[model samples]
Target: MSTHTSPAAGPDAPAQPQGGRHAAGPGRAGRDGGLGGVARRVSLGRPGDPRWARPGLWGVLALAAVLYVWALGRNGHANEYYAAAILSGTRSWKAFFFGALDAGSFITVDKPPLALWVMGLPARIFGFGTWSMLLPQAAAGVAAVAVLHSAVRRAMPGGYGHAAALVAALAMTLTPITVAINRDNNPDTLLVLLLVLAAWFCQEAVRTGRMRALVVSAVLVGLAFNTKMLQAYLVLPAFAPLYLVMAPGTSLRRLGHLLAAGAALVVSSAWWMVIVDLWPASDRPYVGGSTDNSVRDLVIGYNGLGRIFGSGGGRGGGGMGFGGEAGAWRLFNDIMAGQISWLLPFAVIALVAGLALTARGPLRDTRIALLLWGGWLAVHYVVFSFSSGTFHPYYSTAMAPAVAALTGLGGVLGWRAYRRSRAWSWVLPAGIAVTGAWAFTVLRRSTDFVPWLAWTVAAITVTAVAGLLLARLGPRLRLRVAAVALAAGLAAGLAGPAAYALTPLGSAVNGTNPTAGPAGSGGFGGMRGGFPGGAREGGPEGDGGPPGGTPGQNSQQGTTGDAVPGARYGLPADGVRGGGPDGAMDQQMIEYLRRNLDGATWLVAVSGAQGASSVILSTGLPVIAMGGFTGSDPAMTVDRLDGLVSSGRLRYVMTGGGQGGPDGGGSQVTEWVRANCAAVKASEYGGSTDRSLYRCG
Candidate 1:
């Protein structure tokens, strides 16, 4: 909805005094009841002067929460890799902070632990029900929607600005990948919320030129860093520059403030890193995913530049590279485009028009907002598009806010500019056309995926462009024209993602690197690991099927050339089940380990995190994930195993060939166990060829 305020009253308009003098600049609108004052006055008694404003906003938030929280337990440990960690974290504070897969602190999860720590608290209080584990993510989703609204409102003032904020909030809430990620136990929900907070604080800092607000913004982003490491820094380049340029201080003062803020960022981001590093390595679990048992190396190598350039060394989960043989269009290709990039074209267009229209005047707070969000989107876009490391469609969740913010804010302002100049009116139509056209191109790749989308977008584009051109002939129908354009434009953007969201894709998304969309739409042609004609799903350990298995074989294919009866622990292609034992590992497998391994310090030692987590989560017993996630880590050697067995500390050894796991150790461990230990038959564990339990002698 585009509201046409007088040019002088526009959010970008220079403030003017009633008496005589022209006001000095843009951000001082609060004194005369600007965006800040208007926001402050609103309450439950009077959410808005129009009566609907307060209730409408609250209603949106409530609805978003319901969507995020309702039946969330159905997801049932959506991503098993993380699900196992949540289970472990709930059991022990040490495991929680270290992201250990078990209470014994064997090996930390690949990423930092802040995200797990947040999820752990509720699970501890409520027990490890799926709802309790997933509640934090759902709550974060609601808060992100609310904070994003506030951030946009502050950046773009007036009723139109409020409308923009509302639109942004809705867009974010309904985003397919965002909705999916939020409903699951993924860390992305917290990451998005913290980023929104950082944006809001940065907006406040620019509005007031107060260093404290800037510092707060930096701190929030630093916390985000703790949540996801290098991924959080992507927004800093946009944020820091916007603050320096838009802030009202002298150059030196602004520079000094930024310097202080940078210090704050470093301190906040690295505090955990420092604590974990300084803590004795002997006390903590080996940092999973690092060649050296150092968290710092994990940041610089595996999770850092290794993501941009393929892993130069093999120790990290760095793979053959993203796109595999698919090439650079991977993200824009049929499998990924509909998941998150639907609005990208419109956002870019709105950004150009909004900045161009406002560019002539002194930089207003809205312009700064545009720069912050737009730059954030651009840098990430380039990185995701070109990066050679492991990537997923779900990773695009971080990009959603920027796309929504720019579109919502820019759309309103662009419309206002369009009303004033006939030339500017073309910008809106042009943007919508490009967006619709791009969507058509992407959708056409999977024509059968969403049969009606391309035509619906085409019709809407034609109708929208016609209406906008018709509005040029008269003034009376301008609002109606704008409404048509807005509706049709939104229809163009929302059509594909909405369709994709309806699939079982949300729960079906799994594995170390999980992409979302219709199953086969992704690069390799079908679901990774579990589905037909695709790469076998591997965890943080390694890639390909279990050793000696075919490339496109399902996880049921075992190394011994026999069928594994149960679903792979983290590789279920079906929608997550509600309540009871649902997930990759069969319940009987968990029971067998539980019944036979009484009084044992370790329930079993599995080849990788996937197998070990399957049992640990089910039984809440200590299970060693030898070789860590991908199974390459030398977490425990054969000598240690021998000692444990001899001392009766561990009684059983379970073996399988895991992707990226310690297969290099060869048949020695498996061979040694077979030669000496009593082998528990598959009949005792039901029908899976993958299962082999050895009673260590």
Candidate 2:
């Protein structure tokens, strides 16, 4: 590597030497007429690195897509709670537009309608099915990867941008919690998307100090607020320190931009708040988690407080917050461990090496960015750990990017350091191969390695740890080699889930229905006419699963579409059934229940996320809430509503498919009525995961 250059490779040269000594022989000239005459030097955008969005981006995309599909394939089983939100549509043409602008009154509270609308598209056109419901979250996951890449690159140092982005994307996209969110149609996906978006804008505002960017940032942040209230607001503080530190003056102008962005956020978010505000307070679900509260409290208070102090103690939750063996600091450790579980064997040593060592100045920003991102995650985790009440690990998703960025930074920095110290180049490749093998041991999924797998993983982890340490002091190249290999191995681990999703889907949707595609109504492996038992699912693409009480894609009817004459409210996709009860189960249920009970009303104790689905399915009857249940809950007020059953007023109580494993054994309400009242009749459900008809017990 000589600093000196040949006469031809003069001042404004291509930095490095061009083609072999053979040279640009013959008529190779810039203004030459023939192809042979064309002369151009290979262009490397990032100096010696030619890739733009580096190999990691594509690698991540591929992995993410693969993982997304796998998750898709593994999409809802017998469960229909979260699976059904994907089916909601604008009821009428007017509602379609108004619903888009209406905070989506029909869906569960906790967030705005943008994400739901985005996800509803595929389901609607594809016909409701099992996996089709997850498409939107998957799309959001991909977009997040892209945005994070640009943000880290432009705002951070040492060119760790690529590594940081790759890791962040990997962490966020691969996390179990993220998988849960994407599979379900809850608001977490939307909230996370908006948060990331706001952060991206924040980066822009900081880097360029552009008023427009700030305004964009503010508006997005506001939308995030609208989506999930204070959960999105956290984006401002957690991200602002670095941004403000890098500000380019113009304080007054910056203020104006911030103000404008705030205004956008408020206005956009208020569409629902205003409406919900106008309604009687009792009508709003301002207290409960999903069912009872409006979008505001769920997002602003419940979700927000939970993120800060956790919701375990009493946060209206009673489950294991972190799902581990500790609390407070202990809990934080558990979270960190879970987040970086795959990298557990080497994370610490890698961090030490990255920090105790330094690379080219070009790597500074990368390092800083990784640290900041990591800090962001750590901060959120700490907040949750110390929360007064209970909390779910999914709450820590915000920090996933940081963990990945740190790993990526470690890999890149280690490699750079090894390059600077040519003393152990041989060791580099050997260490890489070994480290890669170990990483693969930890990350790779091989049913073949069953018996010896645990021992092998443990042995490999130790050896891998040793290799990482030795690589660190041995030479910079060795360190980098190990880092790259490790990252590659972790990435490889995602293949299992990815490949599974890519497989073909079954007949989730009915071919006769027109909407259900080949294989099924949804993604690969989905079934037609819904799950084998016919459980509730998302709309359109739903493979037959319904929304609320469990029907099929058609169950999400009445909740979606605008109330206009021809605004896609009732129009079904190519071969799908119409949106309403013209010939659907909802129509049948409403008709049958009407015949069973002479009373104008019935006390319906329903569980599952899409109660709106039930409203449509059991049309005409005044289905009063027997009890406010959640997620496939089958309990009813036999003590109170039993009279309805006895007097032939209540008529029936519906049980859900996918409500519980194997009939969801512990349904006291159903049992109570069965023991107390005389069941008059029972009817089978279509595309449902559980029993749908109970004339009366």
Candidate 3:
């Protein structure tokens, strides 16, 4: 087998497998016939790679599948907000395309519809259910682990690349928050997958100098942009510079390629937004989060700058401070640390160490890998740390890939330094010690949950650190000492996160804020509350109210709601139907609405998506959200309601306490309903006092 290295990969780049440019073909088959050949090709690994490399990659993927897909149905419409959208999408192609909260296309979800399109297709085919809605995210999560491994493996040199890739994949698979998000229907799961895939393509472009690869990466970024809007472009800072510095070709040509790629990015990202913005507003659902009924405004205001500058027209208006006060320590705070920061400190140390170690290497040295992953970490760290927006702990999933990659690379680099350079031997032990200490601190925050694990991790850290340090002094015993040190160090580093990651398997996670671990496990304490009508604290039993209910009220009534059986989270198991954050309507209300559709275009109009989502899910019918997701978007007006009512398209209006916007303010539609519609007695529909049904027109 011959080896070929791209000029950009440098002379020291890892040797490619046989068959020259078209490796993983006859060259591999002819040398290692039968199963061995298949394994080599399946792994896409180098000739010197160990046999375990293939199985190790497979093992990581298997672990991820279990973490993401196991008992997924138990979640049962995890994030019913998105689940309702998926259900709508399953029933109506228009709703699917627009990410509408209802089949009638009254309002689109706050973000774009790509994720809905991804999850919707499966749900459409499989019949809408918990598994169909969430499985795509699980598959994407596993694929992300695989891609991150490939990116790290290809960037590092020789057999060490395989080891690093395995470590990176495992770290990502077990990163508590990553597990939680993948198990849910949130767009961030797909966003992380796309960003990592973009990284993989960028790494390929750097290695091969292929303009096509770079362009593909840019397209993936654009798709990611469509998935979550502005959040996808965060990788540009890391990707563009890495290619500019190390991609093969003259500076001018590389710049030209990037310019072309940037053009591709703009086109792919804007196409949908353009289409939506240009569509006649009356013909489509109102752009959910925008103050004006415009996709452009929604993108630039609610989903874009609103997230960064904290001034927008959506719910919380980006100033909700859901992830705690933004600062350098935000990621390490109790609300977030258990979710993603378990390996963050070590990844940072690894970044610094890896960069310093490769400082003198050629332009395409392994330092490019460090910069790619390190820059990603730095950019997200800064933005997430300081962005005073409506943040959630699951938002930290964006940082997991970078942190995992750096940890793997840094670990390999540290081991190599320890073996070859006496002066740098301390780097390996230092990283492990710091990681162990941080893990202990994080574990202590949940002492009751895992009383013995913190001290056990501390003891292992001391042993591993001591072993690694002493191995430096005794050359004869070094190999044995280092082996034990490596095992203990890995255990010490992964133990805390692995434990937290398993918590989701034991019980249902909060679909809305999807954090790992049992309640009070150093995760966000107010998970149930903070959203518009959700309770402020103490799960569903607290005084703040059932999700989507008025403050100081509990509207759970009737038979157990449509929340899938086995749903252990705060979701109402009582006869409350409409399983959304705006609070569920009693079964009788759903029945009344169903029986009285009577040629009405919509079964009912409610205050917000929170109020409308559950009804849409329960009835599989169109309902109108008078306001949008946050209940603040000017999606509805008194005139629109009167027109619909007069046209005999809207017959029922559910208004009052639980239906108000996030700010507890009522819209003109609500006022008009109160003035012109006849209120039905709560006893008639089995509805709570806080929520009354008004018959209009």
Candidate 4:
């Protein structure tokens, strides 16, 4: 086995295969000259096959790069919320550390800055183009695929290990949500990458009984915590147990190792939160999504428990359901199923079967693989399914790696078990049939999303089921028919997501909330407009909300003065810049803000990042995103704005359709501004009323 071979390979395994067709009796080399010897060695991943492994791994990564990086600029600073943050971070170290939404450090984005820090490097070097800001995510996606392959290769048996690794990598790559996320600037790409790396290191630590590897694994998880806050710890239940069960150590020593690793996690993850909290509220940007202006509140209340219990206004935006219900079926619901659950049924089956089959075995490698990936899937599954907060379909991107790994490893192991015992033959066929049926059910949810997928899935399902049944013809026919069945099953699972992924989502999806599926155009064959941020008019930004509402709109309940008060999020545009009521203001507005507002600490204090981020992007001025995302956080109070205005640090204010806008759900700050500040006539800025700017005197 390789030096890094996982515990699954067994400690006594040899570096190379002991024998195969290439054994060729006695001392004869597998490649001993002539066509005869070559013919014997000519097999897929055969023992003597040296040329394919490295090349195949590279090939998978190359394909991932093509999918994730090629034409990626079309996304154009995808998720402008984060894009704007990156832009600010590149200009100032303070903004970079705080994850400030605007260059002026008025308010930070809701999450921690680790993702932005990684993205900021390229932006700092390459000057913050769409390419620079998004490349890190694409590269992370490719690395994730490579690392997943490495983990699988080390864990699975040799001959078929290569195939399993390739398939898992491809499955993850083709997952539409994963592709959508990586191609865009979403932080889940970084989160997913770090988790997979942690998994790999944990696998190594178990195999080698190395304390260093185990410590590295814990550190990565802590780092992941920094990346996405508590969401990164979702895998801890499985991760901790795996080390305890598999690591080679005595009772006391193992306890010490686990305790020490726990300390590392606390130190690594908490240090950042500690520093931010300790920095003094007045010294740093207001914690964006927190109600109390505390980073800990942002984490524990908003990003943390709010994600599960559905409290806290902005971060917890109710349910992901189109009808605004965050029910138990959310994971399998129409809107989310197509995005990430296409292979969920198959993965669940494989996990159950793999665990059951290996349950009695001596702490073997396959058992360990199942525990890790299955644990990952189970934990995320429960949280995503039951969580009542602002869970988007794209959030399921974190679950993609676990599902893909389980599918590959589980399918391969089940197939081997089926061949060895007649009783297990039922497992493979059952998994295929169930997965196909589930896929059909999921695809049918929105036929308009993919018109032809219904029939295509029907055909694949019938064929795969038929092929699995046909394998009973005889031993010789069994292997051939099963191979066809497996291939058909794989194809059946990938078909729908692949179609969805092949279409470009375009630039309008640059928001805090974006969904991906087999859908229609903004950049052709993709959905347009996202909610609650400044987006181009008539683009994807204007799709879901009330007509002529905020550029980055939301569909929360009880907001006064909207045509569709709770009808989804932002409205989609007609692809015409500056066309109708829903159209965002032209660049002239930005130029006006830039030309004026001299020497003010903040050029303008706007309701949310949606209204302010665009202005900041256009002028590089300090536009305060008063409330963090969706204009819902009470980051600023009336007194805070009064002080800014009194001190002459804030000269202009824009209000309307944000938190505490005319709706009365936002802070008293907007009302106070309205009571004191003079409204700048809309005509002065070309009759653009989406944002009603005022001169604070």
Q: Where is the poorest 10-residue window by lDDT in model 4? A: 572-581
Query: What ranking emerges by lDDT with the best candidate at the front?
Result: 3, 4, 1, 2
For each candidate in the order shown, give its overall lDDT on alpha carbons. 0.69, 0.44, 0.77, 0.69
TM-scores for candidates 1 onward, in order: 0.83, 0.61, 0.89, 0.83
Winner by TM-score: 3
Residue-by-residue lDDT tens digits, candidate 2, 504-618: 2321221111111112212222233323112223323333233222223333333454232111212222121111112122433444455655653443433333343344322
In candidate 4, which residue ranges exceed 4 Å CA deviation? 1-52, 313-315, 320-324, 360-363, 448-452, 505-510, 520-589, 661-676, 682-692
List where candidate 1 sits over 4 angstroms from the true fold. 2-52, 312-328, 504-516, 522-592, 596-598, 663-692
TM accuracy, model 3: 0.89
CA lDDT, candidate 1, residue 432: 78
What TM-score does candidate 1 get on C-alpha atoms? 0.83
Task: Tell me which of candidates 2 and 3 scores higher on TM-score.
Answer: 3
Q: Score candidate 2 by TM-score against the native.
A: 0.61
Per-residue CA lDDT of model 3 for 152-224, tens digit only, reads 9877766677778889999999999899889878899999999999998888888788899999999999999
Sort all candidates by TM-score, best to worst: 3, 4, 1, 2
Name the lDDT value of residue 170 in candidate 2: 61
Candidate 1 per-residue lDDT over residues 155-228, each given as its tens digit: 76555666778778877876766866776666788999998899899888977789999999999999999988
- Global lDDT of model 1: 0.69
